[model samples]
Target: MDNLRRRHITSFQNGVLEPIVFDDKRKSMKSILLSSIKLQKTIAPVLSTIRNFYNKYYNTIHPLCFTFLSFLTRFYLISLSDVVMWDESHFGKFASHYLNREFYFDVHPPLGKMIVALAGWLAGYDGSFDFESATRYPEDLNYTFMRIFMASFGVLMVPLAYFTSIELGFSKHSTILVTLMVLFDTAYLCISRFILLDAMLLFFTLLTLFCMTKFHNQSYHPFSANWWKWLIMTGISIGCVSSVKWIGLFTTALVGLYTIEDLWNKLGDLSIPKIDYLKHWMARIICLIVLPILIYIGCFAIHFAILTHTGPGDEQMSSLFQAGLIGNDFAENPLEVAYGSRITLRNTGFGGGLLHSHVEEYPGGSGQQQVTCYHHEDFNNDWIVLKPREMEIYDNETDVEFVNDGDTIRLLHLATESNLHSHKIPAPLTRAHWEVSCYGNDTFGDEKDSWVIEVVDDVYKRTNHIRSLTTIMRLRHKVLGCYLRAANVGLPDWGFRQVEVTCDKRNNPKDTYTHWNIERHWNSKLPPGGKANYKSKFLREFWNLNVAMYYANNALVSDPDDNDILASKPRQWPILEVGLRLCSWTSDSIKFYLLGNPAVWWSGTASLMLFILTLFWYLVRRQRQYTDFSPGFLMDQFTASCSLKTKNMIFGIHYALIITIFWYFKDIAYGVSSPNIELKDKKWLSTWDIVD
Candidate 1:
């Protein structure tokens, strides 16, 4: 048996039995423990490697966290106590109406107000005009919620700006710089504090740019399904931009031009045969032209549906329809009416358009020479160097006397009148240049010398005396001269008016007297003797002058007008409201200028077309020169330096999709929570209303 066992052992050593014996019982257990220890050691390093990989790849902050931070920063930057800048008041009013489901006129589209209303609803603040609550109220909501929403938009802009900058061949540092500049700019901050459409418009504009960049860089076979989806997305983004502002139509034109350039660039070295060229071209055309139009029309359809069914209030709906009808009519006939009355009411016989009249020949005498004096030739050319001419004031105890070398003088005579007393010193003397000076001693020397004098009547039947006469006199000579004289005598209050002047040449009598009104003096060059019917037109054009002067004065006293406020107020039928609001903070002229129908769309379209044509020509020339083309070349050139690591790109795309989906569902949630009858009464709401 031992010999057999030894043989078995020897055989087993070559096979399995000897190994089993060597690892028997306690030895086997020790061996197994060693193996287990080795496995445990290996597991720790492997697990550690895996954990480091995960942390490196997926450690970005949640989007919600960033969103929250953005909101907080916005609220801090825009304090609640901040006064409503010009435009914010209009937006605030609209948002309030939106929250209450009350009607409000809107010249602009409803997207911006809708955003503000959404924020207010999320915060559980009722949009009422109640002034009782210090916090959690509509007024508070107006500033706070709008700030938070806009701040969030501003923050979201950072990544998009970075992406666009990178795509446009900028360095990472440049991207950061652009983002920081946008974030900290006073214009951006001021705009974010109010509910304005610009932030939203900018956001959509950037998004469209990104989509176009993506389409230009992506690698896709002709007619690939994935390529079609990207093209559709590009069209949708551009359409969304246009819906925000009519200026977005320019953006659509840009996309169409890009598509044409892309196709032309692919034409020279097309990998596919000529037979397939037409198909590829058709696909591109569909993406560039047909798809964009469809998307644009789709957005309008949504707008139409919303306005028809679920618009804020009855009055708002009526106004919206009326505005729409008016817009349609204007589109059909774009002619504008000229601003002028049938006949020139104030005809000096030398007339034309108001702007066409010469300054020297203005009905209100030439600005060059005064009635009694002329401008000095030694004055500086600089406007700031010109100062008001100086005049002297004199007091002679009993009477004031004004002396100047000029032929004209303005006499302000202060006299006291009493029912108990009336007295005069020297009057009833008619010389060549004699004119009535009421409440004054109308005395004249034998010579045609100008004089200003006043008589005073005592209050308690006392003797009358000359109180005071203040005169501003200008000497008619080669040089401009001014002098003032004053005398004081105790007197009560009285009123005076400038009387008509009749000049005698002998006393030189030249029919030089003209009609004087509150603001200006009207002069007509008629013969020395004729039926000179001088009627005062009282040109209330002072209103226009005051408006212009107001702007100039404000420029001198404060900063330039707030453009943020001007840009926000809508300008359709609701323009009256915007104008009223602007008048509160700006000159009437500026209000008119902003509200006036300037050619915003036409100018923008022209610029867009020029850019598109230039880009097209450049792209075509490049394609002709370099015929060896590959899809990879375009992709690599367009997106080679973008920091879209595979994992991050995938994650970003997923996150974006989720956010978009969330937006759609959030609208639904808002609808469900709304105080409408469909939700409250358990009635089935049509899909048209829901989608809207």
Candidate 2:
């Protein structure tokens, strides 16, 4: 009774009295509820005012404001310094090639370079800059215009993002949020403010997604001109995307999937006739599949037409292919091959380089002077072909002397005054075979250096002349009974870091490296067809280029020789775990880092996961509510008016995954346009003669 001091306290409500228990916990909870209500009331005015501000200015004026901000942020101080940053050396050189109409090979498609070239050309650039080693820009060069042009694409990304959000029916605030994320991203800013392909890539990617979403919204009005316009635009955007890099294929795939899903849903609609569904499928096949392919091939065609003259890409292409180029040597008349001919042999194997010899000695296995395969054209790569015991008897004037099978021969290196010889000495890199070295004196080489010509087939084995661009032959060493081969391994400095060549006993004529071709042959006599019969086929040459590009892509992705230091695995990209060194000045003077923004990248990753979870949650809830989770129903539900959050989530996840997978497959962030950094131990690119 004494402890219950407040037990008799009662509250009067509606003229009724009731006993009230004095509970500290209950009172505290009531106080918290009242404070929360009061706080909500107090903030209501501020929230309404903020909403009113957004409603008043966001739709009409905000886009322009965002564009202004993006332009200022990206373009301000863009010409901060004249020093080359990141991939400017590579891309700038490519652009110059375009302006000069110089043919160059790259693993990527040509649209991005073409755009850069167009920009530079419009800016009064004379196409004379080499972009060598981050050298200073020329005084007359309008370098700022080029930088500003590239930044303009980055500027466009902000509005593109904003428009994309709006097209997907997102709220004004949500659109602003998305725009701000892209505008403020440090990675996008850094990459876009330079003359690189990334900004263009991002622009196309965003444009593609926007067009795709617009197309999706018009699905109900299929066959409408507006629908076709969006679909066609999406296809064109895909071409632009792929023109930048092969990574764009991921986005293309997503669009394809979207089209398939749309068609599948249209097929299931009971009101739509089967013929209507067929028409829809046909339209997509034409617009999505065939149209994009044509655009892609068209880009290549334009690329080929613009770059008519030969340049640095000559070695990467086949000898026949190079001969067809306008300014190349073979452009005049195809040279014929004959016995005792001075020629260069290029192996069509994995590395696909020229047989070469230099003064440098082998460091690892045989202590002889190194014999290797180089890709570029060099005087050192020239060799004199001689048939043993016949070279002295035969003269260059002899009527098309044919060196047939079973003929003993020797290759004398013209530059080093040494015979291309092989003995029982094991190869340095490929130990299973004998070693090939520049051995014996020039003029009169050793008997041990002799080799027998072995044509792979019976037709060519019967005393047939080895013709250039016609016959494939192998050189079998008489002493070691082995065939000369390229080992696909780089040698030390002595060999100019080119792939090592060896003599292997295994005679797999199918092996590309062992099968040799006469790349360049000198003979006064003309072939049966004559020079007029020589013709270049565009389709065949294009196919060959495709093959070359495929091999180049494989080498970069796999890093088969483990030479690339900047190559990162796919898993490292999402967490912002690695950064590439764009450029360096000595050890500490200045450096540029190619790193993604931590905040933007991490948030994208988080958004991707959250979107996936939300999608699953929505699907599960739908399944539980309807208990009829049929494909048609689910498709219709998704195609219908989805919530803004759901729409954004889907697009965001798709966008993130597309980019992530693309970068994963490419392995390198800057594509082939970026200069590969050289380390003391590892070499990224095939070694070429350093031209002064």
Candidate 3:
């Protein structure tokens, strides 16, 4: 290459790949050392030859060696602590629920817990142990076996980092540094040693990234079998990561970005056949988009199939769905809705809640009793389907009237005796809808309290008469014509933090938010619906369950009154602003703190900032018509790879630095095994809440 072209190429390398074999930083470092330490100049060429030979032969061996060492590092003294730590209290309990085959709900998907349950089963655990925080395990529990099983995932992350880097065209030396950085990460090691989902989450995240890069490298092969294999694997990995936690969607988005770039490049290739381009598009649609969704659904299918008994999470699901649980007796609820029937109305929308009213009044809306959606079982959720106050008032002698389409009725708040009422005031959350509240005594409700029940559909019975737990219906205000809706947004703290309920102004017949189903019927004049009478399709339940998971996750706002000492904002994360206390601080118990190796974390941050600064300089120079990079840094990819010795030294130094830092903090990751430690030594930062 010409002098000018090499300078332009070297300029870009100085910004990005400066640590690679072919940069001037190595020469400068060597010169500084030689002048200060009086090193012989002839040693340079010999050192270069050694690095060249090692790079050519040892690239494959390095990742395997590091992976073996990582396994040792991660699994060493893995069962040092018998007490539960951090999220293990929650997630370990979930794994036990899975082992017991009981249905439960969580804000996250079920795959991680299921995987942990498999490990527990293998360890001969009978799901009888309590995973209370900082509580010691019983002698019979094989918690050691379980911890080692989960730590293997963390160990594999070392080789994954290497393979991911190599697939992305990183140099062999850089790959070694990357592998060591992950291998000795104190935080990663500590998390994997416990019974938590984070280790599984990270393993799948790296797997997703590695699969994406492998697929990218195969872009040249288009529809070859290997290409197809990797594309499908990428989708499967994405599904795995997402199933571990919804945060995996960020990984999916990254893969999506790469797919878009690949397709765009293929689109611009004039020589490739248009049919072949279309094939590429169709393949991506099938493997990347459709395959991931199928995998996600498959996980839920497995989740539903195993958890067959009623659990704490039954209320988070629909009443009909809960009825299918082995222990739930609600399946025997009476089928038909009649006058004087007590029931809970469930909103039919995805992630919907039970129609509820409490004595607390809406501060900004109608000032009547607050009507909201309750996710839990509460007496306030119960309402009576009764005759409008003036029409056919409920009396012992009055003939029973089954509610049907077009029947005008009033829903009496069974706890408070207030009728469900709607008015012209704006809703608390959704401005486009009217406020729905309970008003007037059961004997005095007027036209505003009247609702015309319109049956939408029925699962088993197609009659116009409403049925409990099956008939889907909408409640249209008799006077204002607004449909009752369980708004997805939640009310503020003063309203008890329940989901907002409103009367939607639009006549959107397809709006499921406005749809309601009678649940937990208490009518005595009818026969039991029978468990055999109620059934649930997994697909419908799957979507509804996932939506409920999403809504529950979004509803988790930080409680203002909760002095969450262990939690830190994202801004405090990178610079080691705080470290979490993983277990109890009692003097007799062992302790663990989740803190990353400062050497790796701070350097990565510095590297990222340096890249941003260099890119800005290049852009500003280019706009001034500077010939410094006439043909641009695109040519840097073709620059020669030489001067290997300096890269080898840098890689060695970085690897050693990571390991040394980890050793210094080994007590924190491996647990402070001895009791009664000093507070100053444990607390590395002012923000850390570690106790003596």
User: In model 3, which runs have C-alpha deviations exceeding 4 angstroms?
Assistant: 1-60, 348-384, 389-401, 412-449, 460-462, 482-514, 559-562, 616-645, 674-685, 690-692
Instruction: Name the candidate that leads on lDDT.
Output: 3
TM-score of 1: 0.37
Q: Any idea how many clashes model 1 has?
A: 11
Indicate the worst ten consecutive residues by lDDT in candidate 1.
Answer: 346-355
Query: In model 2, which range of ten residues has the least summed lDDT?
Result: 683-692
**What C-alpha lDDT, on a 0 to 100 scale, does residue 131 get in candidate 2?**
86
lDDT of each residue in 15-65, candidate 3, tens digit only: 674432354666678889878665456677789998997878786668768
The C-alpha TM-scores of every prediction are 0.37, 0.70, 0.81
Per-residue lDDT of model 2, residues 1-692, tens digit only: 44443535788978999877776666778999999999999999999999998878767688899899889778867776577776888889999999988889888888898999988998999899988766888988888899899889899999889888888776554566677667766567767878889999999998899999888888888889999999899988987898788888889989988877877777678999888878888887887788888887888889888887888887766666666567766533334455556778888664478888888788766678788898878998888777664346555474666666567887888888788888787887677888888877655667777888777632122336565644567888887788888857887666677897888788787876787777776555654433343444566557667777877888766545776656777887876776565655353224444556454677678867766765687689887785533322222245347777776776566446534543432212222222334221222223311110
Alpha-carbon local distance difference test for all models: 0.37, 0.73, 0.83
- Quote the positional error of residue 50 for candidate 2 in Å: 17
Ranking of candidates on lDDT, top first? 3, 2, 1
Candidate number that wins on TM-score, 2 or 3: 3
Clashing pairs in 2: 349-513
